[model samples]
Target: MNGTLINYFFHCKRQCYLHAHKLKTEHTSDLVKLGKYYHKEFEEKDEDKKMINGVKIDKIEGDYLIEYKKSNSDVKASEYQLLFYLWKLKQAGIIKTGKLKFKDNRDDKEVNLTLEKEKELEMIIQKIKTLINSDQIPPVINKRKCRKCAYFEFCYS
Candidate 1:
């Protein structure tokens, strides 16, 4: 349950549940459209979806997770998201371990996650799941990162 899908809920539970369990949605933004393009570009099914699901990966070594970012400013969240994906993989028994990778053609740069920081991430996962299942919208701290979130208005309003 700790994956991109869950991370989406970390921002907005309703959105995550709607998209994951129900696949319910009609509207799509430019960012989402572009994100789909990136995912398609980096996806590699030959690697075996079942195999990659819960295996511990040292590095992206391959397309493990093609996290596309528009800038380095969002690296932290991207890493968190990727780790959550790994967690999901682990939960589903797909991957036992893996680090994050961030790529952005806009900045012509890439960042390989070196920080383990798994303990902290594990703690947050528990908290997030608790809050999400409780059916509560997390408070907005009004950070710069909130600017790009699709649910900003719904949550902050």
Candidate 2:
């Protein structure tokens, strides 16, 4: 889970560990609830989260790797996450471009990541791995990322 998408999820390291290890979070936030709702709405009727070459792809449509985003404004992180998914999809022989956007709104304001972006995301994944191995929770003093973070309680505590 040290991929692009996971890297953007930077509120708490312990939570990241649980997610990376595929452990479910006992408590979820309203945002998580909204995402689940959106996924149910937009994902293909048969789509289920899949791990392809160690990458967790939310869904795939033809030659597109689809990853839903639920961000208030910072959409770049979501784009990077989708790039990470595409990078993994490439490894799984599902090479394709990726699109990241709000699932519920469908406002057409999307962050599209190119193959180059995927490479950039690959570099970022390395950095994230190093940071995680060091066992440090990068400060979110401004709390912008923390506000909507699902593990806010754990992070604040």
Candidate 3:
């Protein structure tokens, strides 16, 4: 799974399901466009297509996998997304720690994929598979975050 799927899994199950099924709406979101711009600015010169099991890693600096984000509004989700990349790298026999860099906040958070965390990520991947295979979309949670979500209109309108 990609980082977007992992991010959507933590943010909204409905979004996870919709995105897995190819019902994308991020293109129309101004927030998404802005995020893309920030990501481009932080992107490394090489390693743009650093794909591991279909997940595109932002950058690889020696033994660290670097992920740059626009904000820390959903730090937990972002953490998991970084961990997911680390896990994929480990599976490919390239173990590496993760560094989450928030450009807007000017902060960096480290993420290490431990044995326990790797187990947890495996479980999460299984859960994601189950969610995507199911026919029903998850119900709207109506959280405040929905207002800024790219899939807001698809879910509410």
Candidate 4:
């Protein structure tokens, strides 16, 4: 229902399930801490949390929805997360493009929403809803980026 849910979907299903069930581990994660610090240090005056339909947007520039990232380690997941936001905005009759800002690398990537992408996002949202509603928690699958994930310890231990 939120960006974190979409992000966890791309990263790890187990994480997504855990997060949806209110099992949060981000507060104790160094990686999460670093990310928060990075955002705080580079946060612009105009950048503030804007909630739209329960989804908290990082920032909005004119007609562009801007999402800031600390790194590009999971660029795919990040992209999908941004797309999900765009989909949500579009559903509310606010058509806006997305811009991904990587502060550490000083890079920016533009994201455009299309009919195909919207259909894909809808399918994904349905899957996410079904997964979250299920009583069974998804199994954990190890990955290279697991070490830096906020739910790493919770999943591993």
Candidate 5:
């Protein structure tokens, strides 16, 4: 139920399941390398990176939880990831808005967890649990975006 799991659930169910089972392939991905680089650079600045339970938050200012992404290619996945973080914080009695920052662009998006969205997120979380706990792997998407995924080779070749 971590943020990465939430993000992967939206990005690809197979990826989420594999990751939960510790079949990590991120180190073999250039895109993943770039993302790690961005996070490392941010961490080097000694900026805000605080962990609440199992979720790692990038930044927090006033009433906002800021998330940094290496690219804007998958904003939807990122948004849901941030929403999961917000939901986690709320469980700890901390409610805040979510802000997304992309290193590849200047387009920043804000996310708020409304009652409707919260309900949706809760349902998503349950679905993710069921998906990752199963003995089966989801079918490969086989889309163009799949070629760029860290699990591309593992899924295709």
Candidate 6:
């Protein structure tokens, strides 16, 4: 139910479900570490980080809730993660647009929490809860992208 969960839910359902079940492996991931280093290195301001509902947002500046990524490897995932933050903001009676900032300098993607997207998010949340509770483990995706995932060893080995 955190932003990473939302991102992983889109990136790989198995990773998301495993994370919910506390089968964490990201700490051992070099890619993950690199992203963290990149994030800390580029953070605009310490005060911009915000915490709400137990999730840490990267930054909130003006009308944009900005999310930073090391790369645009998964744009959809990044966008949805930002959207989840926007939804959280809405719940707190704060509405703002979302911006995705890639350390690789890819063009930013602006996300708006339209009514349609809000409904989609509701469904995604329900699906995430269901996936987390289900006893069945999701099958390995076995894609090239899986090679870069923190759960790659757990899934492929």
Writing each residue's lDDT as its tens digit, candidate 6 over 12-128 gives 999999999999898999999999999998675557686876657788889988888999989999999999999998988888999999989879889999999999999999999
Error of 2 at 148 (Å): 2.1
Compose the digit string of candidate 4's lDDT tens values, residues 1-157. Answer: 8888888899899899999999887899888899998777656565456788766788888889988899887788898999999988887888899999897686788898889988888899999999999989898788887888888888889
Q: Candidate 5's residue-wise lDDT over 1-157, tens digit each?
A: 6889989998888889999999998898998898899978766765667788667888888889988888888899999999989988999989999999888889889999999999999899999999988989999887888988999889988
**lDDT of candidate 3 over 32-149, digit per residue (tens):** 9999998988884655446776668788888888899999999989999999888888888889989999988868899999999989988998999999999899999999999999
| Positional deviation of residue 122's Cα in model 2 after best superposition, in angstroms | 2.7
Stretches of candidate 2 above 4 Å error?
A: 2-26, 44-51, 109-115
The Cα error of candidate 5 at residue 3, in Å, is: 0.6
Q: State the TM-score for model 1.
A: 0.55
Candidate 4 CA-lDDT value: 0.86
**Candidate 1, after superposition: displacement of residue 148 in Å?**
2.7
TM-score of each: 0.55, 0.70, 0.92, 0.90, 0.94, 0.94
lDDT of each: 0.51, 0.61, 0.88, 0.86, 0.88, 0.89
Off by over 4 Å in 6: none
Residue ranges of candidate 3 with Cα displaced over 4 Å = 44-49
Predictions ranked by TM-score, top down?
Answer: 6, 5, 3, 4, 2, 1
State the local distance difference test value for candidate 3. 0.88
Instruction: Indicate the residue-level lDDT of 107 in model 4.
Output: 73
Best by lDDT: 6
Model 1: lowest-lDDT 10 consecutive positions: 106-115
Tell me the spans in candidate 4 whose CA falls farther than 4 Å from its real position. Answer: 47-49
